[model samples]
Target: MQTVELTVRRTVGRSLVFQTKVLEVDANRDDPTIVVACPEGLDPLEHHFDASIAWTSALGRMEYAVTTRPERRGRGRVWLLTLTGPLTGVQKREYFRADVSIPVVVSWTDGPPAVSASTNGTEPQTHRLAGVVLDLSEGGVLASVSGVPPPVGTQVQSVLRIDDDEIVHAATVVRHVSLAGGTGVALAFADPSLHGDRLRQVAFEAERKRRRGD
Candidate 1:
């Protein structure tokens, strides 16, 4: 088990440590922070002015020494944090994942070439397919569908619809095959920056919900 420690800093720059385990770090994005869950029967914000947070990971002990402000986002049970300065520590990355099901549209450049009667440089013909994302990470997604999917190495664009929000991303089909229930394919994003942060947040949110049995 991992724990997160919040050290409070007062106007005099003095500090105090408030340790808790009910925290989630959303570090895959450009701006990283720890989401701390408010302890039962107590309000954390009331006890601290500005604070610094630290935790340990695969890399080693990681610390965000800069003073940070906490904002109440989502429900009052949690606080979203933002550091005022650069996070100082070894950045050892270990990927985390969450099981989810989402509908998406996949368009790929794997169709047969067309012998056009006109000779003006032609673009590769593309095809569209629909699939359900079984699970997703910042780097890739596993989509389950019916029938044979595009061959491995196919360059694809996936539009994942999260409620009314549509996020478009570029990916490559790394694996495609038949399953007992349906065809399954693994897609690794060409560039995760297009949707990595958003997907990471979604995965974290899913984990939070599951932990609460919601």
Candidate 2:
């Protein structure tokens, strides 16, 4: 265990895991223990009795087993959680994200193939849905859609546009959608290429430059 302070986030959404100040830590001990002020909202001990703590140390980001069965300290909201063992191997992020907003078209087959009377051609009954890409990364795009979001585990073809460049990729809608966030959904890219990566990066940089009055 290292003595350096760590910033931890939930692995899924990269949301802050805690908003409390560290009260005590015994990193030198064989089995370390950490005491932190409980957050104002949810009680960790209620559900997260045993969970993983993702933190970045001097070595890198890593996660370790943590027990939330707190030992109350007097009347204050501070609670102690024991780290059962040493920190596990460092965790490496799979992708870098670029925050931006861009128009995206998601196309998916609704049902069986349909035949066009004018063209006399048979094709999959595809439906096109519009969304705004809230964040772009090599792994996925988090988008805020207009209408009802597709169900989880559904795979769809997406066309992302950054200026004149349009890149198409297959993506899956994640289950953790936020309706309050304008029907937002997380789409994981099945196969991302360098072309799409460059487009997203360039678009993000351009947006940054614009905000700088450049």
lDDT winner:
1
Task: Give lDDT per model, in order.
Answer: 0.67, 0.62
lDDT of 2 by residue, 1-214 (tens): 3222222334343322332446778688776777766654545454344455543333444666666545567546555567755777675644434568789988777665687779776676667789998877656788888877777888988888877978788889875467574888788888655354364355445444444445
Alpha-carbon lDDT of model 1: 0.67
Clashing residue pairs, candidate 1? none
What would the TM-scores of all predictions be?
0.56, 0.48
Highest-TM-score candidate: 1
RMSD, candidate 2, Å: 14.1
Off by over 4 Å in 2: 1-93, 113-124, 179-181, 194-196, 203-214
How large an RMSD does model 1 have?
A: 10.6
